[model samples]
Target: MSWKGFSLDSATSERRRPGASRVTAVKILIAGGFGAGKTTLVGAISEIPPLTTEAIMTAAGVGVDDTGGVPGKSTTTVAMDFGRITIAEDLILYLFGTPGQNRFWFMWDELARGALGAVVIVDTRRIEDSFAALDFFEHLGLPYLAAVNCFEGAPRYDAEEVRQALAIAGHVPLALFDARSRDSVRQTLIAVAEHALRTLTAGRPRP
Candidate 1:
């Protein structure tokens, strides 16, 4: 909720482990369309209290912002959300959640600069809303996985069906998760990390 003690500069600084084990810090982006739950997912899984830049929705965004599918939503992330989680003693993940509105997209390039990979959260109710995120990561050639956030009362589809609908590459990992659950989100993050590692490995030049 507040970033009083945390700064991006300090958060990304090298950390030392006093023993033989070394610590590796990873940056990950949480991206998706408006109201797709990027904020919620980060908050649920973050070990530290997440930093959020949410603002109340107003009449000024009436025509520019679309909230039809998420009629009850009244707030939006105006900037990025920051959070940290330790996957292991040697591995820490720093999450950056991008703002979903078109006007804030210019910040994506910066948020994604050092990110190892991304998790594209999707809402089946507005499945089409996820296309822009998919395209952006694909164009950047960044390794990422699609995560379908199963909101209550929303129509459900199996993983394969959703994958086909999204038209993602067959090898890309696809997962179904409840964004509100810490366990579910943790599993999703692990999946993306593994997927990204495999992708990096496969692309390395053979010795």
Candidate 2:
């Protein structure tokens, strides 16, 4: 399949017949501020129907939940989003999307345990909303990629400009994507995986 602009090889290649016992699983976290498309992304790329724990917005959150940039949003994730995708015959990715509201932030540490890396989705209209998520990953020293989710009417910024605005280090990868597209989501995942792999190898002792 073609993701972003690159073609991916067939996942059927280099695989044992059905029932092979050598499959490897990698955990990936999808994190962002409220209304940044975390749930949308997990649903788009999951092989199975994604599991979500969304609750309707109500008067109770009128003053507490910040709905400035996402005025139309009516639901929020209370727990987490879960999904799975098989990128290759032997490689499976387990996706866990964190709850975006600050009240739900306590769940992040549990979800991040054993995760290979994360994709921090950003909404250009509410760029500052993502700061907490970015700081969370940085403080843990986790390798991650910042993915700017393009939305209709949102201002467009070049990669360097976004990097500078977000104060992302030169080593971290940054890219743009449409979270609703399967190809785009796959491409983002590829970037995260590549970044994590590089960081892992770099920390290892040379042979």
Q: Name the candidate that leads on TM-score.
A: 1
- Residue 151 of model 1 has an lDDT of 74
Tens-digit per-residue lDDT, 51-129, candidate 1 = 9999999999999899989999999998899999988676788999999999889999889887778999999999999
Give the clashing residue pairs of candidate 2, or none.
none
Task: Give residue 117's lDDT in candidate 1 (0 to 100).
Answer: 83
Clash number for candidate 2: 0
Residue by residue across 5-92, what tens digits does model 2's lDDT show? 2112221113345776455567789999999999999999999999999999889997888988888899999999999988765567
> What TM-score against the true fold does each predicted structure earn?
0.90, 0.89
User: Candidate 2 regions off by >4 Å?
Assistant: 1-21, 204-207
Candidate 2 versus truth, CA RMSD in Å, comes to: 5.9
True lDDT of residue 32, candidate 2: 95
lDDT score for residue 15 of model 2: 30
